[model samples]
Target: MDSATHQSLLNAARQVFEAKGFTRTTIADITREAGIGRATFYVYFASKEEVFAAPAHQVRDQLVAAQ
Candidate 1:
C-alpha cells in the first residue's frame, strides 16, 4: 500500500485499539473507523495485537528521541 493508505490504517488501528483495547477491537471496527475496507486493514496489519503494538512502539520511539 501507499504511505498515505498505510498511515491511515495505522491511525485508524490506533484509535480503535485505544478505545476498545486490543482484545475487544476487531478488524471491521478499525476499517469502519478508517473509512476503509476490512481487507485493506489486513493488508497493513496481521492482527489487532499488532495494531496495538504499533502505537506503543511509536510512542517509545518518540520518547527515546526526546531523551
Candidate 2:
C-alpha cells in the first residue's frame, strides 16, 4: 500500500466529511480534496464507507489501547 497516498486520502476524507457531512460527501469530493484521481481512490479503498471507517477504526483502537 502507498502509505503516503493512503494517509493523504484519509486526511482528505476527514476534511470533506467534516465540511459536507457523510450523506452530502461523495467519492468524487474526497478524491478532489485529496488532489488525486477517482481511480486512485478505488485502488486504496473499496468505497467511501470503507475510507470513512479508517479513522473511526484508528480512534477505536486508541481508546482500547488507553483502557
Candidate 3:
C-alpha cells in the first residue's frame, strides 16, 4: 500500500484506540475514523488488531527515540 493511505489509516486507528481503548474499539470504528470503507480497511489490514499494532509500534519508537 502507498505510504499516505497507510499513514492515514494508522493515524485514524491511533485516535480511535486512544479514545475507545483496544477492547472497545472495532474495525468499523477505525474505518469510520479513517473516512474509508470497511473493504478498503481490509485491503490494508487483516484485522483491527493488526492495525492497532502499527500505531503502538510507532509510539514505542517515538518514546525510545526521545530518550
Task: Please give each candidate's TM-score.
Answer: 0.82, 0.91, 0.86
On TM-score, the stronger of 1 and 3 is 3
Clashes of 1: 0
- Please give the clash total of every predicted structure, in order: 0, 0, 0
- Give the winner by TM-score: 2 or 3: 2
lDDT of 3 by residue, 33-67 (tens): 88998998988999988998887887899999999
Pairs in clash, predicted candidate 3:
none
- Report the alpha-carbon TM-score of model 3 versus the true structure: 0.86
- Which candidate comes out best when scored by TM-score? 2
Off by over 4 Å in 3: none
Ranking by lDDT: 2, 3, 1
The residue ranges of model 2 lying beyond 4 angstroms of the native Cα positions read none
- Tens digits of per-residue lDDT, candidate 1, 28-59, equal 98889889998877788887777778789989
Error of 2 at 28 (Å): 0.8
Better TM-score candidate (1, 2):
2
